[model samples]
Target: MPQQVRGVIARSKGAPVEIATVNIPDPGPGEVVVDIAACGVCHTDLTYRDGGINDEFPFLLGHEASGIVESVGEGVTSVAVGDFVVLNWRAVCGQCRACKRGRPQYCFDTHNAAQKMTLEDGTELTPALGIGAFADKTLVHAGQCTKVDPSADPAVVGLLGCGVMAGLGAAVNTGNVSRGDTVAVIGCGGVGDAAIMGARLAGAVKIIAIDRDDKKLEWAKDLGATHTINGGQVDAVEAVQELTGGFGADVVIDAVGRPETWKQAFYARDLAGTVVLVGVPTPDMTLEMPLIDFFSRGGSLKSSWYGDCLPERDFPMLVDLYQQGRLPLEKFVTERIKIDEVEAAFHRMHAGEVLRSVVVL
Candidate 1:
């Protein structure tokens, strides 16, 4: 039987999302139904609402989420009903080349629910990041649910599903930040601050945070930044160089994703240093720079996709760290909001007022 539940959806491009009746079909052979406990309001959801992601109108918004397995399809064995889990977009297919090479994190053929979730009128909805979790319940491939400690707050651990994971992975995984490394993160939003935390966890001795917003910079400091640079008042690249003994940082991460910020990240790194791009850029955005610069400055320039994370391995470990008070995951949840207040949360996010506004169901 199909269940009807209230969900937030963007019915058309560039329009406000609304609560609508959504239909969730029973899990198929490899699917499970999750009863959402909380979902974070991410910038990507707003992008979907604004038609920035694609022409996938009627998108079911919200992706960063934590929930419980309410039911499972016949073939499901990894999780049982009532298991606390963090929802992830990546459901690696073991047969894919990436998975076969033991790099399931880069799996090319991720899985989603075989059945389509529809609106009350039977119109199919495009789930955000393949895990539309802004509702009472959502259908997902069984592999999408990564079990974590049930004691942790859903609002906090849920963040590991997306932005938080992206930022942390950007520094730890992509940038290969290590002990005694000097790291600079450009952008002090949730993602940037998460990168700071990751760098700290990786034993970075000097962590410099750069941002235009003073408030977000303060937040970055709380998350373990050794110094903060006001990018609006100072040249970010020069500031980073000055802070790192006039040599720049070993790892520079651009969380802003704009070409200007990316260039700043490139120029703000020591010679042969790594630069990680974790911020997402719009499709129409373009960059033009001297080809020689890329050759002369020899180091890794990597784009971190979902923090290059494997949710199965990372989520549980992060949750354990959070439980032990080693990771300040709770700090990311700036506010708890109802699902209906998501639109306002988007405005707050755009205004740089909150780190994250989570919808607590």
Candidate 2:
């Protein structure tokens, strides 16, 4: 039987989200129903509400979530009913070309529920990132569920589902931040701070944080940034170079996803240093720079999609690290909110007032 639950939804573009009746159908073959414990308010959710992602209106607007599996469809052996799990957008299809090449992290085909959840009126809703979770229950492919230590805070570990994972993966996976390496992260939002945490976890010697907000910079310090640069007050590239002993950081990550921030990341790295782009940019954004500089830089420039992470592998490991006191994942949850508070959380996020506001179900 389908269940009717309260959920946040963007009924139309550029409109505020509302708590409405969402119908969650029972899991079909290869699907599972999750009873969400906590769902984090992400910038991506706001983007979807603003129509930045697509014309998919009436979007069920949260994806970074942690939940308990309430039911599993036939043949679903990966996760069982009553398991605590984090929902991941990227449910790799093992037969895809990327997965066949042993790089499931870059799997070209991902999985979502084959069946649709609907409004009270039976209108189909589009799930954000294919895992709409700002509700009491959500339906997703069984592969989208990643089991983690149930002891961890749901509000905190749920972040590993999206932005936090992207930032951490940008440093540890894409940038390959290592012991004694100097790392610089541009943007001190949740993602940028996660990069700082990732660098620290990877044993980076010096971590420089760049952002316009002093509050975020302070938060960066708590996350292990060795230095902070106010991009609004100084030439961030120059400050980073000076802080890194006249060269620059070994790895510079752009978490703002703008051309200006990208250029700063490009110039803020030492010669032959890596630059990782993890921030999402709008479709109209374009980058232009000297082609010669690309050759002279002599290092990799990479874009991270979901931090190039494999949920099955990275989610459990990260949750364990968070539970052991090695990773401060809880700090990402700046506040806990009710489902109806998602719009206010979006405003807080836009005002640079909170790293994350999670809805506790």
lDDT of 1 by residue, 1-361 (tens): 7799989999898778899999999999999999999999999999989988899788999999999999999899999999999999999999999899999889999999999999988999999999998999999999999999998999999999999999999999999999999999999998999999999999999999999899999999999999999999999998988888888899999999999999999999999999999999988889999999999989889999999999999999999999999999999999999989999999999999999999999
Model 2 agreement with the true structure over 1-361: per-residue lDDT tens digits? 8899998999999888999999999899999999999999999999999998999788999999999999999889999989999999999999999989999999888999999999999999999999999999999999999999988899999999999999999999999999999999999999999999999999999999999999999999999999999999999999999988889889999999999999999999999999999998888999888899999779889999988899989999998888888998988889999988999999999999999999999
Overall lDDT per candidate, in order of appearance = 0.95, 0.94
Clashes of 1: 0
lDDT of 2 at 23: 96
Model 1: residues with Cα > 4 Å off, grouped in runs: none
Regions of candidate 2 where Cα sits further than 4 Å from its true position: none
